[model samples]
Target chain A: MLFDFEIQGGDFATAGNASSQIKKILKQLNVDHRDIKRIVVALYEAEVNVVAHAFGGKISAEINTTEVRIRLVDEGPGIPDIELAMQQGYSTASPEVREMGFGAGMGLPNMKKNTDEMHITSVVDEGTTVELIFFLNQTPPNH
Target chain B: MIVKEIVEKLNLTVHSGEAGLSREITGGYTSDLLSDVMGNCDAGKIWITLQTHKNVMAIASLKDIAAVILIKDLKPETDMAAQSETEEIPVLGTSLPAFELTGQLYELLK
Candidate 1:
């Protein structure tokens, strides 16, 4: 099944709705709980970025028996430095966003941590797109 | 400890889901940031924060938090309360400031 949602930027009240809906769908689809949790976390983080950082965005999900793919696209000022943004404690979130308990610079890192694979594309004046994939058939590797 | 005791000790008002007061909470995490709460908080911990948004309930649902206490007497909106019911997580309100409530809870749990 496929699901898509438009994520409005700066809409703190509805920020996680897309992820929550995805989580419900995954649960009903009988996706593994661990994998579902990871996907939900990654989706929520990306959703938050779209709201807090992007001008606005859309999230789309494709689900199959073997895997799930989530795409987040936003028309906002693109990241000036992807490497710095990927650092665990680096953030450009405003004080208001931080006050709401986010912007600890963990969003992207957490997204990367939770998903099986992640891809990011951006342009300075244009926008950013983040794609995350979770495989249903593979267990997370043990350390 | 039961949520009721935590509420009483903190002198918080029950915003919704009074029945959840009977539930046991093994630990507590106090934060306004949903991301930290989600990334670090253990399942079933009582979450205390000053944030009274609907998204707080969403985070609680995702993290499986035992319940949410909105510190500083911050009352959640009606929509937020409704969302809590939908998520089956209780939302409690407290007049105590974040620091005071955390201190009290720490002493009680200690």
Candidate 2:
């Protein structure tokens, strides 16, 4: 199955809709509970990242018998240093965002921790694109 | 244990999602960081936080959390209350701080 969702920037009210929908679909497909949790966690983080930082974004998810692949592309002030951004305590969110209990600098790290394979690419002035792949057959680490 | 028991014991005000007061509670997670709760909270747990936004409800529904307790007498946003009603995950409130409520809850569950 293939799913596509649009993410509106700074729209906290509607954020996580895509993740919720994807989770429901995964459950309907009878995906493992553990796997569903991992995927939803990663997707929710990515979705919130767009809502927090980007102008807008799109999420593309492909699910098959073997794996689930999700790509999030956001047109925003792209990450200048992917390595720095990946650090657990690095965040550029505004104070208002932090007050809402987001922007803890844990979003990207949590995304990486939940997904089996993760890739990120960005341009200075354009946007960032993140690809996450999870193999359905393998047991997650420390499971 | 179920959510209603905690609400009664802790003196938590049920602001919305009364339909979900009967939901089961397995554990509790105390965190204001949305990502932290998202990353660590397990299914059937009660989330303790000060965040009162609609996104909180979104996270609760996605994680299959039993209920949410807003600390420090905070209340949920309008959209949050609406979503709580729709999802049937109770949005509870407490006058006590997170530390105190969590401690009492720990005793009750443990």
Candidate 3:
């Protein structure tokens, strides 16, 4: 099955709606609980990143019996240094975002931690796209 | 702590899901950011926040939070209450500020 959501920036009221719908779909499909949790976490983190940094974005999820693929694409000031942004504790979220309890710099790292394979592509002035794959057939390696 | 005790001590209104007032909450987390709440909060804790949005219920459900307390008398829209009911998570409202509620809950837990 496939699902798509248009994430609206600056709309704190509806930020996590997409992730919530994705979780419900995974549950109805009888996806493994552990796999679903991981996917949900990664998807939510990506969604928050889009809301915090991007102008707005789109989240798409493709689910099969064996794996789930999630894509987060945002149009905004792209990451100048993907490596630096991926580091835990590195954040550029504004004070307003931080006031709402985000911007701790854990979103990207947590996304990487929860997924089996992750890829990020960005152009400084254009935008960023993040792709994450979580395999249902394999156990999450010991952290 | 039982949800009833929290309601009594905090002087909160049962906005919805009164059936869950007897539910047990082992701990409490107070944060307005849904991300931090999702990352650090364990299941079955009472989530205290100033946010009054429908998505808050989604995070609580995802994290397995027992109940949600909206501090400072913040009120969620009707749709948000409906979502909480559907998720089986009780939504409570309180006139106490977030900091005061946090301290009060800490004392109760202690």
lDDT values of the candidates? Answer: 0.86, 0.94, 0.85
Off by over 4 Å in 3: A140-143, B9-11, B15-26, B50-55, B71-88, B93-110
- When only chain A is evaluated, what TM-score does every model earn? 0.95, 0.96, 0.95
Interface RMSD, candidates in the order listed: 1.4, 0.6, 2.4
lDDT of 2 by residue, A47-101 (tens): 9999999999999999998899999999999999999999998999999999999
Error of 2 at A34 (Å): 0.5
Instruction: State which candidate, 1 or 2, has the greater TM-score.
Output: 2
Residue runs of model 1 more than 4 Å from their true location after superposition: A140-143, B1-5, B8-11, B19-24, B97-100, B103-110
Which lDDT tens digits does candidate 2 get at residues B16-62?
99999999999999998999999999999999998889989999999
User: Which predicted model would earn the best TM-score?
Assistant: 2
Question: Which consecutive 10 residues in model 3 chain B have the weakest lDDT in total?
Answer: B32-41
Of the candidates numbered 1 and 3, which has the greater DockQ value?
A: 1
Check candidate 2 and list the clashing pairs.
Answer: none
What proportion of the real contacts between chains A and B does each prediction keep?
0.66, 0.97, 0.49
* Candidate 1 residue-wise lDDT, A1-143, digit = tens: 88999999899888889988998898898988878878888889899999999889988899999999999999999999999999989999999888777899988988998888999999987899999999895875561
Best of the candidates, lDDT:
2
Best by DockQ: 2
| Candidate 3: tens digits of C-alpha lDDT, residues A23-127 | 889989998777877888888889888888899999888999998999989999999999999998899999988766688888888888889999999999789
